[model samples]
Target: MVAGERLKDRYAVDHLPLSHQGMGEVWPARDTVLDRQVIVKLTASSVMDAALAKRFRREARLTARLAHPGVPAVYDFGQHKGRFYMVMQRIEGIDLADLIAEHDPLPVSWVAAIGAQISSVLIAARQIRLVHRDIKPSNAMLERSGAVKVLDFGLAAIHGDDRYSRITQSGDSLGTVGYMAPEQIEGSPTDHRTDLYGLGATLFDLLTGRPPFDGPTPTATVWHQLQTSPPRPAALRPEVPAVIDDLVHALMARHPQDRPPSAAAVYEVLAPLARNLPPIPGVVSDQPDAIRAYAAMVGQVPLPAHHETRDSTTAEYDDPDLATRQAEARAQQLATTGNPRAAARQWRELADRRASQFGEQDAAVADYRLRAIRLHAEIGEHSRALRQLHSLLQDRIAVDGAGHPTVQAIQDEIAKLTQGGLDRSER
Candidate 1:
């Protein structure tokens, strides 16, 4: 591919390449048909075998199906001069590798924000049974809007042609040195936990400007990943919080099973720390930031599960006495597994259903609502708890008078939520 070249009479390629890798080179181009800027990838002539061609198309389809803000959208793909070419959305941002170089030892809040965003991408990919074998700073782009995008989804198979798809003929591994998990080093089977380990390595670097284990050689790095234990982030940076340090350890555990069970769990831990972000000068601008403003309102309250209720159990049940045994079982499991927010929401859902059948003054309805209000206060959402309590108080007074036992219980909850807060016994 040369400067001022045209591909399929659609894109106009630039004179120079944006970046070059083992299998292909990314070129900054213009889609003359759409009159928009786009990124075009041209594969190397030497790597254009029948198998690579098939895998390239597969990647285009897989990436196109993702439909996420964090993943770039593929526009077109076809062969040009016996080399495969792919046109994709042009992302204007600095990759995390460069972001770290600019601000070494980033603030804990920024690290948590980026990590949580990547975890969200992983969770979405898991739903489709797609695994991002390689996850590192270079593949994570931090957009100017303070959003993190996980790049190069399913690109590993394209990176490793037929000969090195799983393992090389020379018995070499097929993963990144610093971020590869133990199973990858051993040439064993891998799953989403493998990506979790890579996330751990990425977060460690973000917090300390270096990976958990830094070895001189590739073999040395593999040895450290396999045998050595990761050092505590707090030791390197005393400001690192203890909770985040422990989460990093759990993510980087040698055994995949020892890691956090899912990406949602990791997000729950990271989301709390992803607040009050300090902007980096020259890295991000302040004007017209839509995503941040949108996020501010989204997390203010727990959204009601209208769609879920229609599918799980609804207020329009044929039998007024029917009990949603399945929802009850799920609520118990969520409460027992350190997910009080989800459990509380489930109980609130139960209260609404019971209220539709029996009156709002029913003892069963009051019990479920009280459980949710307490759970909300325990998590420090005192305002939401108070609002719920006041609404319940008015409903009870209208039905059973102001001096009733249920109305008094609701008043007491409002006082506890507003004044000294929930006691140890209440929590």
Candidate 2:
């Protein structure tokens, strides 16, 4: 390959590859037809068997389906000289792995910001029933505008599509050794939670300057993932927030059931810490970003008017009890559908309505409020959870006395939250 040599009469690739691995080689190229910079990934001729070729095409098509700012756009896929090639947007940035190598132990806010961005992309991927089986730091790029782009969907898997071709055989372990989830290493079927585990491992490395589990051999690392519990991130870096430490631990849980229900839930927890990030000295440019310009324009959009008037007939027919029941039902549905944040909002509204209609001391109102508290805690809103728990404790103690088990349990939860620990008690 040379700078003037064209592939498929469109992509003119350089003489040397930007990077190469056992699977394929990536070259920074210029798309002569489109007159834009692009990346061409070509599978090694030796590995361009039927299975690999099918997987390469699948990756290109599936990744193209994902329309997210955090994901690179797939341009084209084809065969060139008997080797499969995929054309993608040439992202200009340093991958997280290289960034970490240059500046280890990243700032807390930057780490949180990068994790949240990746989680946002995962949320999008999850909506389309796509699971990125490999999510190591090397696959996460940090652009000059401070935007994160999740790369490499070569190991992606579609949910409920066992008939589709898979690059790996059944019972065969895949993914980087340090970031593999316990179930993945055990050759068990995986889902979106597996990606969360990988993100946790990546975040751990970002915070502590090393992965949570590393051993002399891959087998030993697998054993560590299956049998060992990593020390909290805060243990290695005292500046790390306790909430982030807890979130990382939850994401890396050995049991899938122990992790957050979805990537959206993880994003909700990380959003607060991701604010007020300090820019990277070199990686983030000082020039105006296109995204910022678009955001500025969007901020000027007009808001819709809120109507204050309600028809008398509609008001007369509206039953408060029925409305409360309906709200509770909606909240339950949202909770069951892997949307804890929306469910918490519904529960909060129900609780407020109940308190306004009846007294705060009412049993139904207390139940709704307790549900909201638990839901908030589930999403790692410890401060809000603690506030609600303390309020509930006061109400329960006033009615059932200080020694009551319910009041005691609430008190215990308050203690745990105050101490920046997770409440493991049954909801």
Candidate 3:
């Protein structure tokens, strides 16, 4: 535990000099019991309202239920010294807002790819009956591996028919002003489509380097989003393709029904455009060879294969402790190299060795499996990737729902593979 921090006695805190949007401060921490790196969000006691606390607790629970690459994983939650706090996965990357701000007038293709990525998240959340309620540039974080995560679910809503009752709270809008859908402003019922609208608005902001509706006040912006039909992306940046402009327009439809049926649909519409996306901002190296090399090396670690012993001469190698240690080693090796195939092979070996030791189809194993599929795709082994992707889609659909974005994304990837290959050269 670090000294001078008030919570050091209770938690092993490593102060992180980062803050965002008055949400609260985040500290890099380790759970003394678990001993793993985590980001702890601490709420100041001064703003502890009973209703808000309840909502925060609900947020923690809701976030934990969502297991997708695009959403941060919540580890634990508790109240210490009258201030509520939640520990979550410490993602390594930059928020889209800062990326866009530093590189204004972002390329159209990059914007489309971002839209596709976020839409995948919404698809996953929607499948589980959760609405993020907020989908802005700041809320999306881009990881070093090029994966995107949607964060800050403080105002998210779980599925319920009475959308008005679920989100309305003392007349204060629950989402970011510029990104909020008009239905949200009118205090009308909302559904998964509301999130779609917000995502569209975010893409618009990123591409044009301006919010879709900027006004003197949030109220005015809400009115503008409600009443105005935004200009096309090509209008703002003529170099942008008509297909992309069509996508943005479809996403920003005033009527929920008028928007794309689902985030998966949005991804399907944008996947091709993503092929033309420019290199990400602040990425140090945007060249194709550099990107490919990094992709290949991500999570790369070497693992030595264990030899099986002959029946009479060898000790029955089924010792639970030994098997467990070996499994851990293999998993670590896989994670280190970021090579899904190697990880998958190791996990399969672990499953055979310690089937009873670890629960069947555990998340750890599933993660490895998914990684293998993605890695196969990354390495241009599309057929193999498709096989794993099929199984992954089946598993997620069973656990979550067919509509889940993770499942849908697997399907989208499969579609892409079916058509051709994973050859995209950032313009």
Candidate 4:
């Protein structure tokens, strides 16, 4: 589905607005029957096949049977005008990917908590003989109340089914390049352990702000997954606790047998670091606490020093405070240590707190926002930085008009990103 295109003349689902795209376009709509907001996922048949459609419907039914707090409730499923669609509870909150992209290399506790919660969901699915063939960050969504939801059961199947073997093989080569397991890349039979590997990849991306392996092509990426042993998460960031490092490596072992036997086991490992009791298989825990953990970890960091001139127009920017000065010093120290991921994380926290304490319109708020954007870009959070830049540019343009210098600068950055101006380190 193209960006900015509106869906027309749909009755059961109203107000269809395209929300995102990759495998398909997700639209936010109201289910008139249920009188609730829902997400309808639509994909062009040319890009999807009959086998894939069957898998989608089957997974939807399987998901409907699941009553876990971490899984989105599937409401309806059908086809219309040759476009396949499924209506599900509208998920809220950013995906872990977006969180990491907005704020890179999240804190150890945050990563562990999210990993444990998602793993717990898988553990529940395992009881019903379902395996989430795909477990990347894109499939995870945060709820408005702050709980995480594991989504996109489009690739899921009953544990032993070979019905999707052919399509899964084809699709595996095309999607989620950085998270596939060796067995998956080899087109071998997959089990719950395959999902574990993907979960590990997801966690690694959150903590290091980058996938352990990257390649110029999908083939090359598969080769690295098959042959490489990525550095332990803490090796990249020494401050990461020892338990997390050991657990992540164990989950990411090249061989399936080497990983924890089940998601329940992974949750067990994460429990202590998370400092919480394990989630009951199907119960929803209080969400505020989870949000606090998330806020603490992916929370925006502080901005570096801005060479302030006497800006008499804005009271907030007239002078810097001791807090801002101290934050700037801390940012510089982290950046200079060659651990920009850590630096980015720190800046995010300070920035978020400052924004709350001050006001959104404050010049200091804008400064912190810009600093977080630049640091995220430097730390390899391209999608996340792009979103932040878009929001900032929109607000600045609204207040200062399209021709303002700040607006122009933002446009220039967007153009550079679109043209691939920034260089990513060779992995």
Best by lDDT: 2
Clashes of each: 0, 0, 8, 10
lDDT of 2 at 342: 91
Measured with C-alpha atoms, the lDDT of residue 319 in candidate 1 is 30
RMSD to the true structure for each prediction, in A, is 19.1, 20.8, 18.9, 25.2
Q: What's model 4's overall lDDT?
A: 0.69
Give the TM-scores of the predictions, in the order they appear: 0.68, 0.69, 0.64, 0.59
lDDT per residue, candidate 3, 1-427, as tens digits? 2333545444577755457335356777766766666788877466667665676676786788677868999987887777788889998788989878888877766777778889878766765567888889999887766678899887787654232126333444577888877787777777778998888888888888877788998768877888888656667777777777787888888888898777777777776776655566555235445544754575375434663212211132223245457676876687578766676666556554432323233444455455556656666777778877787778767775887666676687788877665344322
Q: Lowest summed lDDT over 10 consecutive residues: which window, candidate 3?
A: 309-318
Candidate 2 achieves a global lDDT of 0.81
Better of 1 and 4 by lDDT: 1
Q: Give Cα-based local distance difference scores for all models.
A: 0.79, 0.81, 0.70, 0.69
Model 2: per-residue lDDT, tens digit, 101-201?
Answer: 98887999989989998998987776555778899999999988888999988778866555232665333347889897887777788887899999999
Pairs in clash, predicted candidate 2 = none
Model 1 per-residue lDDT tens digits across residues 138-169:
99898888878888754443121232133222
